[model samples]
Target: QDEVVGLAGELRSYLSLSLPEHMVPAAFVVLDALPLTPNGKVDRRALPAPADEAYARGVEEAPVGEIETLLAGLWSDLLGVERIGRRDSFFTLGGHSLLAVRLISRIRQELGIELTLAKLFAQPVLFDMAGVIAELVEKSGRQLLPAIEPVDRGGVLPLSFAQQRLWFLGQLDGMSASYHIPLALNLRGPLHRAALIRSLDTLWERHEGLRSVFVAQGGEPHVELLAAETGFGLVEHDLRGVDQAQTRLTELCREASDAPFDFARGPLVRGQLIRLGDEEHVLTLTQHHIISDGWSIEVFLRELRTLYGAFLRDGEDPLPALQIQYPDYAVWQREWISGERQALQARYWSSELADAPALLALPTDRSRPAQQSFAGAHVDIWLDPELSRQLKVLSLRYGTTLFMTILAAWASLLSRLSGQEDIVIGTPVANRARTEVEGLIGFFVNTLALRVDLSESQDLETLLAQVRSKVVSGQDHQDLPFEQVVEIVQPARRLDHTPLFQVMFSWENEDVVAATKLDGLSVTPLETNYEVAKFDLDLALREAGDEIIGVLVYSSALFDEST
Candidate 1:
């Protein structure tokens, strides 16, 4: 995201060549790289895409009017750019939620506009933000106003294991690399070491999260600050002298897989430029899994391609200033999940699941095994298209998500297969509500115990309605932490019983739905390697670019894939 901003000055020239007219940015503000969690996802709330210096570059030619100059100055500081422009687009430059809050506060104080958070994200750049502010700024025509106030936003939920992993990984610390997607890049000429170094430098300067390293205060991983301008370097080598370059690449990759992300120096952050037998050049990015997630890899790939493309075009395409950061979102989350909010949400779950029990029961291969790590096979029997279509119709009629229809189907199947009335199943829930954190990626996801009871001879459609109603209630009460739910409800469990529910079922196929497409690239989908625990069955629906692949990793100790 930062790389997009650094190219702001030349945005109009490059992207305009191949993209639509509105695609270009009017101004750009470069900040430190993006922030990351322990598990290696971009901390959207930590985005420092301020607009305070939005007009620094264009200030020379800008109007001398007090309001206009004052506006430009604010843009400069907010954006962290040396100069600000009157025409800069907030989003085009990089402004996002964290900054939006400040912008709204400024509007209330300066122009008394009472701007909403929605309005700030909508109008991200200087001109648009000012225009919105101008409405109330001119109406009241108040005197000099204070710069926007920064909110203290963090510590939403004490870090979860997933979040901790991202934080540790972002600082270049933590776990070994579990996956690698090797791309052979054609640098377009004889291997030039300097050119490669320049490319790596471009990436380091542009991604704040990449530059960020972590430290542990009181035995917990915390954000350790860094100097943004302090750059990254690459050590070069000639593979032509070696018998085969690919062999060397594989070896280097192996080295990277074992290397942990270094919180002190940014582990797995370094790369080597090597020459193939004749003229080919290879640049490999090996970072630890703790700092980056699979999604983060995709984001990095797209941005790197754009950056490289820009360099090829001899023009920089910087985007607009951002509005906020991950920490800010974290702060917002704490406010949203407290007391009254929690109570309202809790009541929904309490009433919805009243006396409801499990939905899926399967005979165990081992009678309550002590412990197990199982990898089982899976086969999906897709309900006929006609049935799926009918399910959707029912969804619209009942006002529920498509998942409810499928979930009901699963309950029916389990009731018939197990010959039991009561069924128990687990469903992982994604707790993304606030608009700020939706696009800002993290493991803001959790698992919920969905107990669906298939009573004797109940109608299929009727059961589905019950399922839909409960889903709505669950969504409302999703704010209560899963741990808290366990504490409050205190669901009973046996020695080998899964904590809350068994035989998990989830339709995460919606995640792969299309959003935006890049200029020349197709998003290649890869099979996911997600680990599993001890269970009779577990299924996940992964929707890649254009395909939905059902992932079921079961306990081989419980049931064979052949079954």
Candidate 2:
């Protein structure tokens, strides 16, 4: 045992020199011989579990006090890991930017102490984070906002800032389906159709937004919560014996996705189940953007997985009852940003966006129309492992994130192509900075217009620094709605383009894009091609393994395949 332990330590140290911190194994085990199958392949099932001590490196220390214990528990819960050590790094344990944002939000919600992303990135270990939290708590003399609680459902509720903007756009566009948030999953196994329906119904009952709609009352949009009996209408089509089943399924999904939602009369959500065979099925769920966002998709899938599994196993609901619903948040948001707070935020945005360019003016294949056609197509791009690695290295050398480095490069490209040194790029923020709304499915995404002013001869490092500073500052004041920002900036309001910016850039983590698992089914996410564009160009990127996969969604009316 002692010799095996020594050997494992030596091997770990040797691997550390060559591998990245995240690539290193948390635990190591040594075996005398390999566990092989009859075909001479490694029998993964036969491998023994690494002992607890294997994960306990000599440098690791257990949580010492109450704060450390609290932080470790939060980390364990978020990372889905068991028994995290005090010295374990969050990133090394698979935490990403999304999780980092959630962590700070959680800390603020639970501890009443505000911490920044830079602080978390600087001190990721449980011990160091705990120490920082302790100091902040001790020095925090001011009172913090109270935790969000369930409000009386009898009163009329106004729409949230984000939701109100979406409502207005819907009015202007006349239910264009451009703001639909859709998720389609391909399932294979002994399918339980009845259980699936029950699970979805329960989900709708649980979140008020799923069953609710926006109703105009006294010339203002207000949320009207529907009854619990609201049916999701899980329409199932038997395509087992149909010709061209896959093609038919694709067409049906496309039609459902493109179907416009009427805010006045809506559950605002739809679900369709297509049976490819006795054991194979495809499920598509679509919701209006007024009710859901990207983060909400994650929450939706997670809750669906849990509810479906419990229902399948005849167990109790594993999820706890939500403390507050979407309507509660909408009411609270209006109350929270009142008096001088709104003016202060507006001033910050006005000053930051002063003298910003109105248009990106990218050369297009055709001339601009009087109004946006909204016709769009996607061009896929990939960065190989080598290039991705080099980019990470560049980010580290410049003291910025991979996102900042990539955005800087993107801005540089735009500047050179458009011959514009002043560039404004719109980016979406999760906007769930407060912990109470993190789990709610609503239109909580806020857009920040990152204006990067580049010199013709500016160096990469300088540009990256400027981008990072702007992103940080913009995020600091991200609470103000983009609609309000536009109203404050009051730029040229052309129907041909959006206000303040024309291009959107967003980065999504792999986990957010990955599919969820069902209890007894093989599940994979199905991608649908939409024929709409919300902006002139939207660059969405996600990391998969060692490479970066990107989709450039462009306006088909303005550019062709060659452009």
Candidate 3:
């Protein structure tokens, strides 16, 4: 009976992982024996189907009040579940950040009340969130503005803000190789190279961002969309007979990462497949940061797997058409940033960041270089489960989030290192705050420079409060591009350092689903040593199962290992 129960739980978990919530089986039954036919074969007709009582055992109480009912319906529809109980947790029901964005948008449309992602993080269960929504509805009825239709700029387009910065930096120093984003994966078991190539080609054809190139016309940068025939090709290397397969794969990854992109020409993305053995292979993907961000990588991997699976199963594409492309977003952003909304956001940022420190004075072991080299290494740190749990509790007590708590701690660390009361940390925001661009693949990430004063020795509680307020305000004005903010603030431009802030912080809570298992093959993320620094100090924190894992990336030219 114990073994049967364990197997049942495993089945449920696997279903949740692979299928929509509603599609998951409500219950499982264990058969003691199978009825046999007169010919001594098992009789399928004698098997009993699971009953409604079995499903009811797993169901929670139905939503009671009007608000609960409305919220339950929304959850059920978004999660593809037939019915949702008031006590059901969103995350447990396979709800992710992207789905949460869609849910919040739908809530605004249906309920006439605005909700933020932070609120969902705080109250994830149906009953709790429904109560919060009810209170919000009682206090004020608000409606969201109609989404802007994407503009069709038929001809040429301009570079995005992040892309423009990268373009100018490339012109300044062509040898700087830190702007490349490389991802490597290992595949075990049977693999189809042709199907993989086809899937990649589909991706290139679907997203114009991958087919874009930057060119300078009249000393100003602009993006040119190349012809469909001009696309990235996959390079193959066979190292099956090599004695040191791992080392050879590492060399290939380094070569791929070091290969510089020609922004002016075309095809800023490249792929390489290394065959380690008959059943093992390594796949490396490298793209210029101008065309991709962290979020775009997730989109690419997810779509690649979907297309690959469809092609492998039945030589046909099953993916849906993208409603909008990255270029459409680019055009929309240009127009929207010039409207009254941008001006209002600009006012908020200008006042909030006025007289902020130009840079974070982090102590370095070596002297700074004249021109920034962008060379860097990283150290990994892990927080134990107990401490991580305490941090979560503290975050709840302070009415904040794990991200805010981590940022507070990071600010304190920088203060101790620099002996400066005013510390500024730059963090990247997904900038896909709009529902239209949420699914599009492109460089939509914007950096937020959060300045916190840590001069006076304050308790953790007080520091958390201050950090929470600053983060909330920062999120409110996050739509303003970092480049424009820099132009507005007009910080002292130093050739050796970044403007606004030198140190950076990031918290990743989204769980990107890994590639589905291909027939007789298992795919997993491969660790690569493609080390290069984009900032003086960068800290990225990821929460995994009651523990916090952190990677500290520091500039090699600025600090030694001991420091």
Candidate 4:
């Protein structure tokens, strides 16, 4: 047995150096002799299966102290694992870029130790990450992040940096419907209208952002929370006798979504119910971007599902009371982002964006318009299973995420097509770094400008490394609002182009599905594509099974469909 163990260890070491990370065997077994067949040849079918430990990355080392225990618990919760060891690699345990961002946020919120994505990438093991945290805590004197607590509703509430930008834009542009976030859910069974109304009412009452409005007093924007007495109203549209009910339902959804909201009148969220038939119905909900964002959509659906289920069971509110509201976060952010911390972030961004190109020279079929146009269309692209698999393998070999690999390739393509080396692309990040705001329905998403220079003639691996480095650095300094970054960088102003980057790229790790179950209703989210393009060109990709599904949203004013 001792000799077999020794042989296994030797074989593991040899394989570790000879193969890629994904190909490395987690465990090895040695046989005393070969099982022979009738022909005196080794029989592969007679080989014994490896033990359960073969599935784990390495030998298990149980967590020791408090930090390790906390991290192990977080990993278990986030990764959906039963047990984790100190030596287990995060990526090997199904951790990806999105999960890594969440992990860092959790660590900062719980332990008050600020960490960077680069740091997490460098030390993915539980023990190693804990060690790094300990070192940072000691060096920083254990200064913790401020806890978000509910503020008095009577007090004046300020808008968050992100909200302020949206408000300014709306005020300047007359509340364009381009910033509206609409959700349409198709219910295939008997849906209790009373219960759905109660669920939505409870939702608005729970989140102040839903019942809030932006009003300018003395030429300054402020958020005013409405009283619960004025409850949310659900507009009912009976279309059972109409021809082409399904088709009409879609048109109504688009119309409702495109209608602009009045910021001064309050209640930025609107909901409508369309009765197509006895058993079929559609629910359409729209909110201004000033109040909600992409991540808020997930939070909204998850909570709605839970609330609807509980209501059907005659159960009270199953959700815990929120620690703080959107206004509280806005006030806290305004207070906390002052002084030297803000200065340091501003300096970093200014230096990073120094002398950067303001616009991408993408080839367009039409002459430039006098002003920006939102009219757009999307083209769908799919990568075959073989190509997707090869890309994953390449990422594994280079120790990078699939996002980095794809971004590098994309930047290379743009660089070659435009004859420009420096390329800046905008990407959104869920800025809910604090635990208190994780469940809140608000505009907490932040934009990141990742600039990459693809001038050098380098291999794909080299480009991947560069892209990875830029992404990590961007996440490290993501606390500063993109609005503030623009102020510090001071790019050349143009009426026809966006301020910093024209092209946007994003990877959706999960689809936003409003999956729920009432007593007898089949709930499925409906995809309502408004075809609104906020940028010159936007590329969004999401993984579906073994292939990659991509949508290229381009401004129709700049290019033709054939082009």
Candidate 5:
């Protein structure tokens, strides 16, 4: 418990560097040990809640009017809580941007009043929120509202180490496909090879993370950035496989995606827009996650519709000049996470993992080997809509969100299957909250090391709260990239110690690249011929409006697809 005090202090110091005064955790609850799921990691849900009650104390005045009563109920319902006193903070109750979006829509549809996600964040509590709603309703004589508009956050930001790697890897795939589209393109309008080349050059010149490379300097890998000339060739080939042109493009993009995309690489990211067939094409755009995020990709895709539309209309000149390159954002990010800024992060990462040696014990088909090899398989479990609704309602009732509910359910599933007390899982965080980094389509994806303990039996209500806290706290410490922690902590990366987690579990809501139906091509995701990695198994959980599906990817060399 004393150690928890120290850890909290450290976190407070680190938080001071970047977070506002109001956002730091006000309480810290420590225990003899954190619990784990079958996969063996800290079980946040199991972390004992502070016995002392706090944050529940509310304003003296109660809901004032009919609208206020209605608004408070809406907040409580959307947030999945029994009660939401006017002063209670929405953020403290697991309200994220996605939730905010949903909240706004509900208020509009139910209340016949309008609200913006930004407004909710700015005035995060029910009291303030009620006032905002009251004013809106008063201003508009009729029960009407404006349509929600999308916001574009712009700026260059630093890439986490994993993001750096994914960037280069995406590029390697780009090189193999003439740095743009796919074979289907050649089968169709047959876009000019020269035109594609021109686009990559333009894109690479505009983004800095692109031309970066990794080199061994003085026996250590270092970033060696290249001043890529704003010129590259785009080669189109026949739908027939194995051509010199396709081979070369494939090699470059895939290799680049696999390599280190760092500061050395200026802000030039590349991808191909290959026309695979008559109207179908594969758009392989690879940028270091440094400049982009999942949300950014959505923006890029939408913008691309505009750019390609322009190009198709012979209006190639409409593209805007970038305000700043990725490097500029990178420099700013580094400053935001100075020494003091990282202290609390360091505490959280080290505390739960201190000298702890264990495995979450996922069911593996292969015998335990001396060396750690990344080879695995994938299994998808889709939850039907009715169950999905149950999960959603349960999250709210537990003062949590669907994300936490899913995690608890997944941890529960893993425990039932593997019978491990400590479970470790990997989840991805879509880091796109800031108003500055929205438009840049790059990778800002991160793999979160989630620890769940399924030791004692917990009812659904308690379990949801536990899972909720874990996720919220995890988000607080997300700035520390996974790779950086691996190097510093020296976790069991090998099978014997298995310092780091191998089984990954992700929950997302993104539509397939081309959700809408299109003609002339199947446009399916093809499994590439990549080797099993040192770390195997990634399970992605996703939801669309009301549907939930889980997709698992593993190493083919080690595990059977059916298993």
Candidate 6:
């Protein structure tokens, strides 16, 4: 046992040098001999599972003190791990933004102390979080309060700032399906179709955002929540015995995604279930961008899985009552983004983007089209592990984040490609700074036009510093709506290009590996080709484990594959 433990410890140390904390396995098991099948292939089912206490570093010290013990237990439960050490990092054990929200809520409930997601992000390890919790407990005694149920302000609500922008765009081009957000999942195993439908119905009932529609009232746009009794437009197609199941599934997905929603009469959200086989199915969900954002998708998926399981198990809704709804948030935003606060935000953004350029002037393969065509294609690039690691190290050294580092690199690339020193890139912020709106599913994303001037030909380190400073300042004033900023700056709007910035950049820090497991079913995300582009060139970078995966989305009308 001692020798095995020693070898495991050595292996862990070696892995630590190259692997990220999360990629390194929490536990390692050693087998003396392989269990093979008749074909001499290793029988995975016959392999012994690691012991509950087994960890990559061999024996781990148990959680010490009352706070540590409590936190360890909660972390273990949330992460679905049998044991968690004091030093174990929450994210390293597969905790993400959504799971973090749940963990923090549970902590608040149990400890009677309110904590923010930022707190968990700052202190991710079990030992550190416990220390923070202990300090809070010492300073302020436990004060538990019951959650207030959301009052259904039954009536038409004003469109949110983001929603208003989308509405205006839809008015300009109602037939365009560029604003659609489509997600498909491939499921294998036994799927109860009736229970799944029930869960989806429950979702539409609980969240009004899914059933919302925009109607003009007195020459102004207003939002109306459709009746809860309204059905979620779900259609199923069986291609069980089809010669080309994969081809048929692709056609179905494209048709669903390309279909436009009537914003005036929604069911803005729709679903399609394509049966590839008796046990294989493809589930596709399509929603307009006006009603949903990236964060809302995570909330939707998490809730769907929970509600489906509950329905299948006991035919009861296991989810808690929502504290607030999307309408409430819209009401609050209207009231909040006015008067002194609104003026302050306006002043900050106007000053920050005072002398920014109107366009990036990226070289194109073809002449600019008379009217913008949202057709686009994506090129993916994967950064080597060594480069990814160095980027992290550089970010730490410069007191910046991986996001800032990648943005800097992107700006540099654009500078090289365009031969322009001044670069402006649009990036989306989650805009869920308030705790009250965290759980609500709505369009809360706001785009910020980040302008960086590289005219001085500064070194990469200096440019990173500049980027970090601008990012911090921008985040501080992010509450100001992007539409308001555009109005303030009064950028020349052209049908051929997006105003303020044509190129955009986004970073996905969270692990969004879409995988769900229910009773006898395994769900995974399906890659779909929906050719629609919002900007001239939008770059999305995802930090997965130790590697950085980048996707450059460019307008196909302007650039070809070679470019």
The per-prediction tally of clashing pairs is 84, 0, 0, 0, 90, 0
User: Arrange candidates by lDDT, highest first: which order?
Assistant: 4, 2, 6, 3, 5, 1
What are the models' TM-scores? 0.54, 0.85, 0.80, 0.91, 0.61, 0.76
Using lDDT, give the best candidate's number: 4
Question: Better model by lDDT, 2 or 5?
Answer: 2
Error of 6 at 300 (Å): 0.8
The stretch of ten residues in a row with the least summed lDDT in candidate 5 is 178-187
Q: How much is 258 displaced in model 3, in angstroms?
A: 1.6
Residue 12's lDDT in candidate 6? 68
Winner on TM-score (1 vs 3): 3
Per-residue CA lDDT of model 2 for 1-563, tens digit only, reads: 76665454456567768965434555677778989999999886688887755663423456788888888888888888787777676765667666778888787767777787777766766777888888888897434766666777778777989889989998888888888877789899998877788888888888987877889977798888878885667888999889998799989999789888889888799989998988999999889999999889899888988889988877777888888998888878887777697888898899989989888899999998999888899998899887997887676566566788889989988988999999999999999988778788888899999999888677776788798788767776777889989999999888988889889999987555356898899998887766678898999887787789988998998989778
Q: Top TM-score: which candidate number?
A: 4
RMSD of each: 16.2, 5.5, 9.9, 4.5, 15.6, 7.1
Model 5 scores a C-alpha lDDT of 0.56
Rank by TM-score, descending? 4, 2, 3, 6, 5, 1
lDDT of 5 at 4: 43
lDDT of each: 0.52, 0.82, 0.78, 0.84, 0.56, 0.80
* Candidate 4 lDDT trough over 10 residues, lowest sum: 52-61
Per-residue lDDT for 352 in model 6?
Answer: 78
The ten-residue window of minimal lDDT in model 6 covers: 52-61
Angstrom error of the Cα, residue 114, model 4: value is: 2.1
Tell me the spans in candidate 2 whose CA falls farther than 4 Å from its real position: 1-69, 72-96, 118-135, 142-144, 243-247, 511-514
Summarize candidate 3's per-residue lDDT along 305-417 as a digit string, tens digits: 88888888766888787777777777777876877978988887788779988877778888889877688889987999879968866665665667888899899988988
Give me the overall lDDT of model 1.
0.52
